[model samples]
Target: MKKIFYVFSVFVLFSLVSCVTADNNSKKSADNSSKNAAIENILNRKSVRQYSDKKVEQEKIDTILKCAMAAPSGMNKQPWEILVVTDKEKLEKIAEIAPNASYSKNSQLAIIVCGDKNISERFWEQDCCAVTENILLAVEALELGAVWCMAYPSDERVAGIRSLFNLPENVIPLNIIPIGYPLTQEQPKQKYNADKVHVNNW
Candidate 1:
């Protein structure tokens, strides 16, 4: 009886150590993968103004939108309305509406980030901005390029887009993003400034 009890104890200890080692390895692998993906997505992100003639796949576009929706909102209100535009004529008109976004004319797709004031009241703009950043990051992750074109706060641009889309009065256009395959490569430059950092207060 004593010999049998000793053997059982040894078996239990060995099994516990094995399970712990396996769990630690699995966690370490997951952590490394997450860290690498985040670094790659962030470091390679850059604005590409010029694009090739190639069309963006629908799957990638859907993934980008999914990522946009994954962003957190204030109080989880999620007061965002996304408008996807792919019509060639409309793309040309968008370029006309925002002169700085002339490169949009060549993009395969354009995403217009909008905020519905009726939903979150005051945090609509802030929530929309978070979604926009997620879209940009997803674009880079999918090996695509995009440029953000401001549309809000500009009466002319906002009115033009609203009129073109027949948007409701409560919906405000925030920005337009033109996405496509890059015509040229852009390297990410480090713009970090240590002086801008404040420990507790600015």
Candidate 2:
């Protein structure tokens, strides 16, 4: 009787341990799957400038912003704001200020991604940059095209965007992204460079 009870107790402990291990493995698998999906999206992203005349739906715009917001931020402050421009008049004015932004005229939508200066200036730029890249990748995942035009790094450009949108003093424009259905496909450039890699020490 003692031998049987001891064996039964050991079996129960083994089963509990096995259950915990299985749960952990399941969680790890899910995490890996999610990571793979994001990698696939990134690999397929391409920068697109020319766009068709069709307008993007509000739902799609919201989806793109949702993805952008998912980007990692400094201390999770998330000090970013987006100005979605669909009005032709406003877009035209923006294009005027951004002379090199002729693509804005053809784009069905334009998003002015801004970062709050109150947030650490050091991370603000990098945080906004991550958001912009996420936005581009999201657009590509949704079968749309977008071009990222720098606006904040330049004082004149930032001032123009702020005035155009009547933004608050705290808000600093970082990038101008024109989004729409692409008229032409952009080929991805080969960016691999083995010489740039230095393992352990440079």
Top-TM-score candidate index: 1
lDDT of candidate 1 over 1-202, digit per residue (tens): 9999999999999999999999999999999999999988887788988889999989998899999999999999999999999899999999999887788899888999999999988999899999999999999998899988899989998998999999998999999999999999988778779999999898
- Candidate 2 lDDT tens digits, 1-202: 9999999999999999999999999999999999998888787777788999999998999999999999999989888888999998888887887876668888999988899978766688888899999899989888999889888778888889889889988899888898999998787666779999999999
lDDT of each: 0.93, 0.88
Off by over 4 Å in 1: 1-23
- Worst window of 10 by summed lDDT in candidate 1: 183-192
* Best lDDT among the predictions, by candidate number: 1
Q: TM-score of model 2 relative to the true fold?
A: 0.80
Instruction: For candidate 1, give the lDDT of residue 19.
Output: 99
